[model samples]
Target: MTALSERFTTARQEGRTTGRTAAVRARVLAYVGLTKPRIIELLLVTTVPAMMLAARGWPSFSLLLATLVGGTLAAGAANVFNCYFDRDIDRLMQRTQKRPLVTGEVTPRAALVFGFVLTVSSIALLAATTTLLAAALAAAAIFYYAVLYTMVFKRHTRRSTEWGGVPGAAPVLIGWAAVTGSLDWPAVVVFAVVFCWQMPHFWALALRFKDDYARADVPMLPVVTTALSVGRQSVAWAWATVAVSLLLWPVATGYGIGLGYTIPAILLGGWFVVEAHRLLARIKRGGDMKPMQLFHVSISYLALLMVAIVVDAIV
Candidate 1:
């Protein structure tokens, strides 16, 4: 009958509408994935604490929100640029094989255009909402990450990750500068903490992915060096990360961090160092070190340290 035909047509149109909606949602998620949200999240974790320490308490909500949003976009832009530049190699790495560029979910030309748009927008947002210095630091961090590290160090040297820690540590400085409008010794000390922490944090991750690096012809330390060498280096930097973090206790004297910060620093820092040594010991015994365990713990270590900073500063 005519009624049955109309019902069939309505159902078909509804199905088409649902399909289009789903496609649009997937496209949006693909664009978001290109930003590497996880890394940006970790960077932001360290940022607010640095801002709190610099202010000796909570900063204005508007300023805090602005700094966080700008930092996210800046880091997102840098990550997008890295994806564009590393697209070819990314397709070869097992971990990166599913990335937007690799799977053709996003085109290279579109990715580059997106990166450019993010670059302009992030810088302009920072400059408008925060200080010029904050904006400049964000720009410098982007270039340091996408250019110096991605293009130069990553290609030629085994020590690339170590040398490339600056951009990873930059959010701390950027956040402090946003609050104080200048850099100080405390900022430098915090920067060193993040820089030192990065070596062990990433080396553990690199150990698990070294095979992928080798497949891609990248010169990561784990790819070029022996496991024993990697373990020894990780241990040394782990201890150095702990020492540098403790040094912040004294340098942050006027910033209101005290026993509250000190307790967590000693406990968490010592635990991280112990975990690093555990990896070294396991390697010496010719056993699997479960590098990913350290990798996961490292994330917790830095996040808790920043939490302690926030609590200590506000109280």
Candidate 2:
């Protein structure tokens, strides 16, 4: 009986230890989830291309590494703050209902503090390893995304996506500044490409999740207007994005953005424009709009275009 009791006690202790270990792991993952890693990946898509273009090829290894890491942290900080502030709305949207804050996996206070730490660390890292302008741009982007877009524009206006694109495009400028220590026409053109590209890209997403936005009382374009109107706006922005992308070759004459980028840019932009028009046509036909089709295509379009930029800059 003494041996049996000791064995039972030991088993219970091991079980408790295992339970604690599992809980700790979950908490750690919850914090990571608050940072929105997928968005950080897209930020990299634009950032690396701009850095390459600005450097006219690969920048120094240390500068590239530092800029990418700092940019990732900055994007993470902005996302965490967005999650903290938008927890209420997120709880209402089914797609976001499983997010860390919404699911109570992370507390708002802890997420807020994490965001601050990330913001400071990212800025410090950038300033130490790259230009001050790069660090400054990162700070401004975080502020714009977290405070202006999340707290104000997103909640109140149908044009939120348009205005919000400013911070979204900041990665281009930030990457260029990291290499060149200043912004220039090339940076501005790439910035405009991303800025104009976001309208159609995000409007397509908004259309797919219109009910979610409406349920949350957010004023996303699709939530505030007809699908037809949103489709028209998307087509307009799609062409605008292509036009701005074309302007990059002229602005970056010495940067080797020649036939390689131009041909692919034209082809890719044509595909994006066609998809946007297809969405509009579907809406007009009173058929299934299938908005996510354009959303997915927009992802491909930007990624491929950025790849073209990379190839052109290197070759």
lDDT of 2 by residue, 1-315 (tens): 999999999999999999999999999999989999998999889999999999999999999999999999999999999999999999999989999998889989999999999999999999999999999999999999999999999999999999899999999999999999999898999999999999998998888888999999999988878999999999999999999899988888799899889999999999999999999999999978999999999999999999999999999
Where's the lowest-lDDT run of ten residues in candidate 1? 280-289
Per-candidate clashes, comma-separated: 0, 0
Cand. 2 Cα-lDDT: 0.95
Segments in model 2 whose C-alpha atoms lie over 4 Å from true places: 1-14
Best by lDDT: 2
What would the per-residue lDDT of candidate 1 be over residues 1-315, giving only the tens digit for each residue? Answer: 899999999999999999999999998888899999999999999999999999999999999999999999999999999999999999899999999999999999999999888888989998999899999999999999999999999999998988789999999999999998899988898899899999989999999998899999999998988899999999999899989988887889899978999899999999999999999888889867799888998999999999998999999
